[model samples]
Target: MRVVMFGYQTWGHRTLQALLDSEHDVVLVVTHPRSEHAYEKIWSDSVADLATEHGIPVLIRNRPDDDELLQHLKDADPDIIVANNWRTWIPPHIFNLPRHGTLNIHDSLLPKYAGFSPLIWALINNEPEVGVTAHLMDDELDAGDIVLQQAIPVSPTDTATDLFHRTVDLITPVTTGALALIAAGHTQFTRQDRTQATFFHKRSAEDIRINWDWPAHDLERLIRAQSHPYPAAYTFHKGNRLEILAATVSQNRYGGTPGRIFYRENDGIVIVTGHDARTGNNHGLALTRVRTHTGQELPATEYFTTMGGYLTRRP
Candidate 1:
């Protein structure tokens, strides 16, 4: 089958590589230009570079709405289009262009986590598993009919970075398998249950700010979700940003206001957590490691020499 791929970053890079290695011919490639956005900078293997190296026609577009790009797609005349991490909404005219239509590779199970930063959101929400889905594109964003879906169990100690690696490795096999099925004229794809669907926004600095009102267990998961290279989950202490690098739920319950620097537990500092913390029945959040705004990383034990202050959401 002749193919056109719309992809960006490492996800797109891997998808393109899969197409290049498959029995299909990747005739044209469309990808987004380099971005300075925080999340876009990570997992960024260049899709454009790989296409050029292989001598495939490449087009760079922030979106696929322009006439020149439309004309180019018509000229390439591909049997199908494969997209991964494309970063923008692809229109019907283009997605519906090919005979078999466009196949999108998303990094999470469909009907849930349908939007950006899916792995991070899933981990923070304590989902038991995480994986990729290959679906046929429709008018709605990521609301397509499922072609192939695969998942992996999310470990208790897994971080967003860990899940990224695990799920990414599945893209190749999923992409190839879906294409082979389509090439063989398989049309009985699964329809997504919109009632069970969820969508999330892209992560920003504001999203990582720690809210002590949350239970310690949830806070701990948030810390892991925003693991290294994706910015740390943070709070304010003494008018400075304190990024929590490692944390756990305390074994004992504590009393007083949420975010209070209460007592030392094991090898970490225990911060009172949960909106109902004043009841003294809620578990506290134990900060094992932290980073100061100045970039100095330290054990929470060394950093909070004397307790009894508050970790605020704002300075």
Candidate 2:
């Protein structure tokens, strides 16, 4: 079958690679252009680069609704349109072009965590599992009927990066399987239950701010979730922004203001986190590794010789 693939970022790059490896002919690839900014880190292997390497026609456009792009799609006459990590809203005319319509690959299980940065969000929330969802594209964002979904357990020690690689490894199988199902005249789709639907907003600079008032366990989860590759969870120490690389829930109970450092040791920096309602006292979050604004990564012991200062809160 002739296929038109729309994708961006690392997820898109991997999906396109899988499609190229499969039996179907990829007629064209649509991907967003690299940003012109110097400081912005490109997290994924470039989809456009990958497509170009395979000698496939690549369209670098931000909006899929452009008249020229739509005309190009019509000219290609694709049997199916496969989308993965393609940001921006794809208009119905564009999505409905192919004979089999558009199928999308989403990072999370649909009806939950249906927006950006899904893996990071899942880790922060302490979700038990995370996986991919290949579904038929409808008018609603990620509300499409599910063609296939397979979950993997979220390990306690799994960071966002760890889960990302695990999920990426599954995309080839899931995508190929979904395509196989569609090609075999199996067009059935399981309707998602609307009652349990949840959508999250795109992450921002503000989302990485570590709130000391949160419970110790949640804070520990946040640190691991946002650790390296993604932005590290941070708080202001002295006059500089301090990025926390690793942390754990401190067993010791302490009494102090939520943001204040209550105890310091070579192993960890035990700071008061939140009020423990059961004990009517404050709990602790221990920071094991951190990097200061000076670009120096160090253990908690080296970072702080003296404690008992309140961490600055910034919006």
Candidate 3:
């Protein structure tokens, strides 16, 4: 089969590599230019570079809505289009161009997380498993018929970064396997249950801010969700931004206002948390490691020499 790929970052890079390795002919590639967005910078393997290395035709577009791009797609005359980690919405004409149509590979299970930063959102919400989905593209974004899905169990200690490496490894196999199925004239695709679907927005600095009013378990998961290589979950300490690198739910309960720097247990500093913390039945967040505004990382014990103040949502 002749293929055209639309992708960006490592996710796209891997999928393109799979196509290059397969029996399929990769005729053209479309990808986004380099980005400075916080999340966009991570997991960024260059799709354009890989395509160029293989001598395949490459087009860089922030969007696929332009006339020249549309003409190029018609010229390429591919049997199918494969997309992964594509940043913008693709118009119907573009997605519906090829005979087999567009196959989109997403990083989460469909009918649940259908949009951006899915692994991070799933971790913060404590989903039991996370995986990848390859589905036929339709008019709606990520709301299409499913072709293939592969999932991995989410361990209690898993971070977003951890799950990222695991799920990304699925793209190659999922992309190739889905293409093989399509080439064999398999058309019985699974329809997504829109009633069970969820969509997410891009992550920003505001999304990583730590809120002490949340339960300690949830806050702990938030720290893990935005763990290193991505932005660390953060709070304000003494008018400075303090990023939490590692944390856990405290072993003991304490009674105080949310955000209070209350106690030291083992190697961590316990920050009182939860709306009901004052009732003395709630566990606090035990921050184990942190980074100061100066970029110096430290153990939470050393950072809080005297624990009597507060970690605030704002300065």
| Candidate 3 lDDT tens digits, 1-315 | 999999999999999999999999999999999999988999899999999999998999999999999999999999999999999999999899999999999999998998899999999999999999999999999999999999999999999989999999999889999999999999999999999999999899999999899999999999999988998999999999999999989999988899999999998899999998889999999999999999999999999999899999998
TM-score of each: 0.99, 0.95, 0.99
lDDT of each: 0.96, 0.86, 0.95
Per-residue lDDT of 10 in model 2 = 81
Better of 1 and 3 by lDDT: 1
Clashing pairs in 3: none
Task: Determine the C-alpha RMSD for candidate 3 after optimal superposition of all C-alphas.
Answer: 0.7
In the range 1-315, model 2's lDDT, one tens digit per residue, is 899999988899889999999999999999987764221244668988988888999999988878889888999999999999888899999888898999999989888989788988999999999999999999999999999998899988999889988999889999999999999999778999978788887777788898888888888989888867777889998768998999887776776678787687448999788744245375688889989888899998788889878776662
Ranking by lDDT: 1, 3, 2
lDDT of 1 at 121: 95
Model 1, position 44: C-alpha lDDT score: 94
Q: RMSD of model 2, in Å?
A: 2.0
Candidate 3 Cα outliers beyond 4 Å, as residue runs = none
Over 4 Å off, model 2: 36-42, 275-282
